[model samples]
Target: MRYIAIDVGSTFLKAGQLDVQNLAITHMESIRMPEPLPNENPLRKEWNAIQLLELMKGLIDRQLASCPGCKGIWITTQMHGFIITDEYGVADTPYISWQDERGLEYADKLGTSYFSALMDRVGEKAWRRTGLWEKPGVAAVGLFHMLQQADLGLEIKRERQGKACAASMNDIQTLDSKRLCTLGGYLIQSLTGSHVCHITNAAPTGLVDVRAGKWDKDIVSAVGCQALQFPRIVVGIDSVGHYHSRWGGVPVYPDIGDHQASVLGSLADAKNEAIVNMGTAGWISRVSDAYRIGEWELRPYFEGRYLPTITKLPGGRNMAVLVRFIADVGQSIYGITLTEDTLWERLLAEADSFSQKFLAGERQAGKGQLHVHVGFYGGQTGTDSGAIDCINGDNLQVGGLFAAAMEEIAAIYERNLYVLATAGEAIRRITFSGGVMMKNAFLRDAIAKAVGIEAVMAPERDEVFLGLLRLALVSEGLYASVEETREVLLQKLHANNKGA
Candidate 1:
């Protein structure tokens, strides 16, 4: 059997064909996602919902054309972010991106931010029920901000009509018919005409009760959006509807979270293994049988499992800051131009060489080492910043700079891993995935050494596509469980390698 797999990623829209019998992915391709729509407020990031949907449809159509007799469609998407829709599932507002930060804007004369005011209104217990911290860009916070704006608009309208406007926070007629959904849920609704969300995709919105696997009524009421409709929550292996096209009607499964899918594709043992993924952003995640409230964020996983994750770690984007700096210096100071790829190649070579020597104690004590922090983009707390210190004439070279950055990232992972351990997650093995980890052996090795455990790479480079393939196998009843499916697939892959 064959299936079409798609990932609506933050950075790219990726698609491919998954051959179930052989467990291979073919015709894999990706296109950069459309840039966010221009905004007057620098912190507000958004996209044209209809335009993004059209682009996704075009990509899916292209893949469907290439793979004849495709049995079904499986999707995974970047978690969080939401779009407001009408009853017919048509977008009513721009897609608010997970990167949007309007919630961080000050909301009162005393200078409390929208996010802070939201937390105060919801209370700590209600917020903790969602298994998330008080942060901006979550769907719940966005919904609150929307309601406030509507109230303000309504008050102005009443004033213009020369009527007394009473505070009717719950009586906004404009929001009466509105619904909320993540980008993935919206895509499913657009394709299959069914308004449903998988638990994995919905859990990150800071609205769902992770332990109960449903929306928390208290949080909804606290946000003053009890009237707003949210998609019905679906669990494991359920089809939303069938997508009709020139080929035929294909079964479309509810979209899953990309983070969970990537970890699933890595084939890590949920009982004893943890995964570290580095893409545009980075996270370290480990699955738990029961939900636990702690420093880590808890997200829903397949089959009643939960993932305790440390997210927003420095990642590829942070490294690009340094690379772009070098590129700018070359162009501006020396009239030389270098592609990012070329610069990365040279930097990696230098960093790798220096790392080997440093690990072997070849450098004099503190002679060629620098302290580097690559948090150019903020961290989980949203206040962290990047820095490079201990810079001297001997350690200010490119090799030293990159080596320090890699070490610092590894150190950050190590610190987070300790936190996970303290919280009682016994992670015996580590599986590394994502573009940065897969391409950079130096970084992978640094992470392994820092964590004091040898790590292994994920079986496939495209973990998200591979994850969709695994989901198809289980959903089609080929395997009773994820563990069993992984075991069989790896066995076949090993046999194939032996024959080759």
Candidate 2:
């Protein structure tokens, strides 16, 4: 029999059909991200729910038709977003991108508690927390929605351009919630017709009390949003019930965070291991049975909580973030309009050019001064006041393929591994995936060499989809536990002889 796994990612949603008994993938495909429509608002139009959901329905129908007798549908999506629905089923918001920076100015408004400490506690490197309100770009709306209206009410706020800060009047480049749509709640809604969120997204809300695994009233109040609009909370895999009671009673299973799903596919070991998934961005992560109330040492470094939970970044987010800026500059210079146009081509060309140039540079490769400290995230904390520390990224370049770029990615990975090794409990084997691993052979080789361990790469691993599939396993009664699934998966895969 076949099972369906849907990976809900930022750029596109991907799906794959897996043979349940054999754990083999039959077919997989990802659709293009549709452009936004002329809607009530430009941002709202970008997430055009009606258009996007229709696309999802069409894809879902086609995939299921191909995989006759498919057991269930499991989905994984970006965390920290939720849709406000009335008692009936309806969408109140679109997908809220964690990359949205609406929450950045929040820390600035908190007055005297010294948001720095709390900011540190929130784990800045998480990527979700890297925006103006001190929250990541993707989750700004959710924070505003979930926070008490009385706290961030219109009367008490300040505005820059047209938008206002959550607390008091202030000026900052905040992300509009409408621009970034919803996340977990909608994914669940689309599947089982239930409006619930998984632990992963809830943990990042700045609303959900991570320790209790429930929404905290104080946090809710502090956010200046509402609690009533949110959905019910559910653990990973507990069957979202039968899918809509339509199409012969197929079941719907939902998993946790986007990275968590990939973690499942990487080795199925739900234990301790730092997952370094280098896609549009690069990240490292490890799971703990119990969530620490607050762990600053654990933050990724650069962009705040803007990254996946598995991400580790002592090098910070600035370095990686800049890669894109550099890419933009290069593309402009090359007259290439589309920056994210191609995967392998862009990566190979840039890295190769940079390597050639750096090897041939004449910037006086002498001593102390020659030692380069590439800061995309943490280093940005001081270097230029505004920088990202994590260096391994797809986009960057103040301009051109500065030969230091390759070393930038490598150096970033090396530093983050140090933090990853220290933050969580005992370390298990490291599993790598994402766009970065899929494209960059040099980065992979350097990673294996730097990590100094037996590293495995699945030339066929579509982690985004596989991660979602693993969640379906939990949601469906087909498996007893994720741990069991992990054991089976790890045993089956032929580990590569180090990095290929």
Candidate 3:
């Protein structure tokens, strides 16, 4: 079977068609976001779904024109999602950006503290033993909620067994009237008629119960979204649903977090491999079959819109801005613009030389001698347009390349790494993708050296789109399981790269 995958992102929507028989993407397309208002304030409504869908539809339609035989689809989006819907399944709101911390202010209203405390008791590791839910992010949110609710219900239920057990995690149900799913689920249902989700995307929202594979008790109480509203839960490899409507009802599967998708698409292999993808933002992730988490990870572990995980840290995109401050050392001398490909080639050459000197143990290390921003992203300036709003990635362009500001960014990135290593120690290897890395090969090499690991490039150019396409194909059940699919993929990639 052939499949079409739709990846609804913050500023863009991507779709790709894959030939399941060969397991390769045949066509790819993207739609850029419409510009925001003049005042930069969001309009009465951030976006209309119909318009967004039409945008998506147009992209998919164009691809379908080439691959008429496609029969399955997989859709995935940013981790925490929301879209308003009408009686006819039309959405009122476009899916919000996974990067949108607009919900950050609602943290208190959502009872985030309770979950924060709960992590202290439980953990962020994936206990993937059968019958025990072990998803990491948003999926953990829902599962944890179910366990909490079950505990609460068990407390409320006066059964002898229940009384003997003291409310534990095992007595949860999927029948909750007030189950809530991220806005993405609603969008999936509207498009395909199946309310389904996957572990990766679901885990990021603090919504899934990692151990129980259900909603966290506190989440439903706080978010008040009905479980019935949830799309059916499917393994990342299961058939999501048929595309059905205009694009043809191809079966669809959901993907996990966008970063997770990027991780998988990067071809990051087991326990030690990881990567730092610098694009609109940067993310460093390593893969593990078993989850590693601790009290330290627990305390600072943020209960994001999804389930709790240990590797949680400050922002990434903001960190890139910090690099830019110091980047001008070579860039300015060469008259290179951040976005210019040719300019970057020259800048990278100089950065490589500068980085080598620093790496060769020639630079003195005194806290006061040189300082940069790595732990948090602010007081920095970079060329990225959204860098400022995302304080974690924003910078003020304090000094030219090699300037104090630039030094600060390197310092900050290093500091951030220390903090992350302290929490997500399980990351084994680092991989990288995205335009930023492409622009600054020196930075990529520098980051790899800092982590003491080799950074693997993504198999294809856009891991984001590949992940979505992978999800679409997986959800279609074109293959029996993700593991199997992965095996096939590995074989094919090996065959192709044999000479390399």
Clashes of each: 0, 79, 99
Candidate 3 per-residue lDDT, tens place, 199-268, comes to: 5555445555544556555544444444435545544355655666564555555545566566556655
Q: Which candidate leads the pack in TM-score?
A: 1
Which has the higher lDDT value, candidate number 1 or candidate number 2?
A: 1
Q: In terms of TM-score, which candidate is stronger, 1 or 2?
A: 1
Ranking by TM-score: 1, 2, 3
Give the poorly placed runs of model 1, Cα more than 4 Å off. 109-111, 154-173, 357-368, 381-383, 423-425
Among the numbered candidates, top lDDT falls to: 1
Q: Give Cα-based local distance difference scores for all models.
A: 0.81, 0.51, 0.48
Ranking by lDDT: 1, 2, 3
lDDT string for model 2 (1-500, tens) is 67777666766777778676766776787887665333443232225444556666666777887877778876667655544433444443343455443333343355523233344434544323321224343343434522423344332332222232344212111222211124645655766666676665665555555444566565444444432555566654556666653456777764456765666566624455666776645566665454332333122111112222523232323334445665676678885554443533565566566555544353355212122344444212212234233343432443233324445556667666666565556555666777657656666666676667656675355865554544455545676665666655555554432433
Q: On residues 1-500, what C-alpha lDDT tens digit does candidate 1 reach at each position?
A: 78998899888899999998888898988999988876678888878788888888888899999888888889888888898777777776677878888788776642687788888888988787787767787888877776776655532111112222343434444666867888888898989988888888887888888788889988888787787888999887768899999999988999899998998898887777889999988888888887688898887788777888888888888899999898898999999997777889999999887766663563556364687877797544322778899877666778878988998888888888878765455778899999889988888988898888859999888898888888888888888877777887778778877999
Count of clashing pairs, candidate 1: 0
Q: What is the lDDT of residue 499 in candidate 2?
A: 35
List the lowest-lDDT window of 10 residues for candidate 3.
Answer: 299-308
